[model samples]
Target: MFVYLWVLFGLFALHEDIVLRQHGIRFVFHGFALVNALVLAKVMLVAEDLKLGHRFQARPLIYQIVLEAFILATLFIAVHILEHTIGGLIAGETLAASVPSIGGGGMQGLFCVALILFVALIPFFGFRHISRELGPGRIKAMLFGRRESAAQAKPPV
Candidate 1:
């Protein structure tokens, strides 16, 4: 599962690199998608581990999952729209009718929801378990004038 998520991210990064190289633009919209996907995956995995959800059930848990999925979907679409608009602007090409239409209906909406859920669930179910099993460790840092031990200033005689 981790490999699959990384694969998806790698593919996006590759695609963005191609666009950057060919178009000579400093920005690639897919880069934003890649970052969002990482965060979304992490959040979903944590939520799932909380056992805050039940599959195919009409419980609050399920609803929360669905809502999170919805949020992911919106973010995905926003990434696409921003990418297309910017790409088009850079190339001096008018966006086609099929490109990033604001009022997409039915199938597109469903597809976005499904994509978001699938991506979100990957991290939610996988990482959450690992994170919980390996609890966050306390890391202490002594900086500035702080010292780990007071006993020893051996003179450099």
Candidate 2:
């Protein structure tokens, strides 16, 4: 999860850099991405420990994965809003002014962000579910094990 969040946040930082560079603003926030990744990763662990989205566990894996992703995305959006609001308040802005526009600006932007986060979380949850079903270390071994030689490889039908 840390690695996933780091890569995602890093890409966002790069996007921000490119967008800001167009306006002659040299802004690089890779450190912010790193910090954000760490914080979010920790939060995710806590959320998991608390079983934030385990209601659909008895159902299909897809249902559980999607439900968990949606829940986590919503939690992340709330965290982002709270962070911005607190920052603004610290800067002496009024309560109303402190609540910055999430995503890009409006409701559509917020939904877009949530959607992106939800999509991003699917793979993480999918892997976790698969790993749990497969038992410990199975996935790691399967992923990193040596490939079969051409002679041993099965031919395409």
Candidate 3:
């Protein structure tokens, strides 16, 4: 949850730098703005499954991965479009003028965003599957690689 936000934030803010900061957008601490851009990502993707396919039905791993990736990428882009549209409306721009912004510098930029998101989602879903298998504590240790202090583990006398 928070980890996904952090990861996506890092990926977009650090890697996409100038692209993300376009249109007078300022880069802030810890990529909070980037995270905010995808705020619906956590809600729409994580809190509820996209249900692109059946869980009980057996399917190839690649099949599932592609499906999840496509759905996520589509919804992610849609959210961006909505944001841009609203911003445009607020600025008194017509829908025609606003709609083009969602294309994100044209198809190339849109593809780039989707590509970055697809790459980010790989680990997003990967860690989730791994977490289910190993449990969160182990996953935390694997990621952050830190153990509790001995003093924090012992019972008081």
* Candidate closest to the true structure, highest lDDT: 2
Q: Where is model 3 poorest over a 10-residue stretch in terms of lDDT?
A: 47-56
Per-model RMSD to reference: 12.6, 2.8, 7.0
What is the lDDT for 12 in model 2?
Answer: 85
Residues 1-157, model 1: lDDT tens digits: 3444555666766766787789777765555445656755565466557654345345534454455455545554655567678778777777673355543456776575557445655454444343434564311222234454546765558
lDDT at 113 for candidate 2? 90
Q: At residue 140, what lDDT does model 1 achieve?
A: 22
Off by over 4 Å in 2: 22-24, 150-157
Count of residue pairs whose backbone atoms collide, per candidate: 3, 0, 0
Give the TM-scores of the predictions, in the order they appear.
Answer: 0.37, 0.88, 0.63
Error of 1 at 107 (Å): 4.0
Ranking by lDDT: 2, 3, 1
Candidate number achieving the greatest TM-score relative to the actual structure: 2
Worst 10 residues of 1 by lDDT: 136-145
lDDT at 49, model 2:
99
> Per-residue lDDT for 61 in model 1?
43
What digit string (tens of lDDT, one per residue) describes model 3 on residues 1-157?
Answer: 5556666667655655676677566664665655664685565555356465336237655555555666777776787788778889999999877865433588888887788777767766666655765875888886688666888876779
Better of 1 and 3 by TM-score: 3
